[model samples]
Target: MNDQMKVRFFKEARSEENFVEEMCNFRCQVRSDLEERSRLMSEIARRAPDEAGARYLDTLIDRQKRDEHKLVLLKELLFLARVETHERKLDKLDDN
Candidate 1:
């Protein structure tokens, strides 16, 4: 979301194929993040079970779940972006 990143995305979006590739890369990144977060959460849960610790864990898990939900939503958006690329390709082929 910085200006430079925004410009890079704009350039990528200019090419349907490149845009799809970029979206795939982004999706992979989000998936990796979710996996790492899950691992850390598991470790935290295992190490902490005192009354105070449980409260902290509950709060952390709630925030983590929200983040996970956003990542899943992002994956869906990426899928939709790729679908547009496929549709455009099909339209070109049909014209040919």
Candidate 2:
């Protein structure tokens, strides 16, 4: 009812929307990076000098896999946040 409450609520709503948008952008960027890395990794592997070099490349590939997993979790969390906001809106409507 107060101006302060309205501002705080609006800011929270804006922040959540911003968060989802940022995450989506970051995920797209990371996906492109992963594609580039995968392409380069294979090219480098073809010319790798020794076992250690090959192993190091493998490590990089593994790290990329982990990053992909984290991105999936981030998307899930974003979805959950959006669902929570929707539920809150429905509850407010019911209260009215």
Candidate 3:
């Protein structure tokens, strides 16, 4: 390919990698935030003045756990996609 095309492709690849890395970082932060929230909620539930308040906190914690699970799945999918992208790029290089 032409020099300009190669440069453009390189830029695009770099941008995509950056985007994926950013997403991974953001997800990690969100997961950490959720963990902290759950921990705080658990502490509050333990010292809760009423049963109802504890139950409510339990529900919130469950929701956060579910959200965290979904986020983990998405992170795994993103990691696989990145690996596949690299594999394809390597294949192309081999072809050339």
Candidate 4:
């Protein structure tokens, strides 16, 4: 939730065809984050349950897994949208 590693939705292009590029960058960042979270979750899960008792760690791990799933879906959708955007531009040129 902090300024660090926040995802931004570009409602409009940043003046050119860079919006797709921006989305790609966002997807990459999200992918990296997902990998790191999974790794950390794995490391934590390796510990004995008694050590991480009270269910706090379990709750956090579950939340991270859910977040990782969401990011995977989001990145796929972004890629699809970018492809469609490119195809539209090509179609416009064909129509002209």
Candidate 5:
């Protein structure tokens, strides 16, 4: 490959790697956040008065749902990254 082609290929690969790494990091963060939220919910359930507990639980539940949605999106991103990586490998092979 010419210098320009090489540079383009390197940049693409670097960007893809960065995206995959970011998705992985996001997944880890979401998992950690969910765990902490769960712990807090449990603590509130144990200690709060019935009405207060109900309100807190509702808020936590909403947050949990949002986190779950974000997790799904992150999983989709990881899947897309895998697909892109495979396609890139195939293209490389075709070029050879």
Candidate 6:
């Protein structure tokens, strides 16, 4: 590979790894948030007004859904990056 391609490949690999790490961190945060929300919901259900508790639960659900969507997008991006890297390596071989 040319120097430029090599630099690009390293950059992309680093970026992909960083994204995957972020995705993992987000997943862990979501799990923790879900656990905390569940506890809050239980408490709210027992002591808070029905409407208020429901509204809070709905907001939590919405946030969870958004996080899930972001995780999926990041996974797809990582897959694409791996595929591109593989293709580039194959191209190099073909040239030789």
Candidate No. with top lDDT: 5
Off by over 4 Å in 6: 1-49, 93-96
Q: List the residue pairs that clash in candidate 2.
A: none
Query: How would you encode candidate 3's per-residue C-alpha lDDT over 1-96 as one tens digit per residue?
Result: 235433543554556667567657656876887888888787777788598877888788787877677676657756765886798779999999
Which candidate do you rate higher for lDDT, 3 or 6? 3
| Model 2 agreement with the true structure over 60-95: per-residue lDDT tens digits | 889788768766765675577678768877998999
For model 4 the TM-score comes to 0.59
CA error at residue 89 for candidate 1, angstroms: 1.2
lDDT of 2: 0.70
Q: Give the TM-score of candidate 5.
A: 0.78
Error of 4 at 63 (Å): 2.4
Please provide, for model 4 over 1-96, each residue's C-alpha lDDT reduced to its tens digit, 9 standing for 90 to 100.
222223344353432366667767766776787678677666666764565542656776777776677666667656766777888889999999
lDDT of 6 by residue, 1-96 (tens): 135433544564666556445545645675677677667767877787688778987887787676566545545655666577577778989999
Shift of residue 29 alpha carbon in model 2, Å: 2.4
Ranking by TM-score: 5, 2, 3, 1, 4, 6
lDDT of 1 by residue, 1-96 (tens): 235445655678788777778867776775777688677768877887678777877876786776677666656756777788889889999999
- TM-score of each candidate? 0.63, 0.65, 0.63, 0.59, 0.78, 0.50
Best first by lDDT, ranked: 5, 1, 2, 3, 4, 6
Count clashing residue pairs per candidate. Answer: 0, 0, 0, 0, 0, 0
- lDDT: worst 10-residue window of model 5: 1-10
> Which pairs of residues collide in candidate 1?
none
Instruction: For model 5, state the Cα shift of residue 28 in Å.
Output: 1.0
Clashing pairs in 4: none
| Candidate scoring better on lDDT of 2 and 4 | 2
Candidate 5 global lDDT:
0.78
> What is the Cα root-mean-square deviation between model 1 and the actual structure?
4.1
lDDT of each: 0.72, 0.70, 0.69, 0.64, 0.78, 0.63
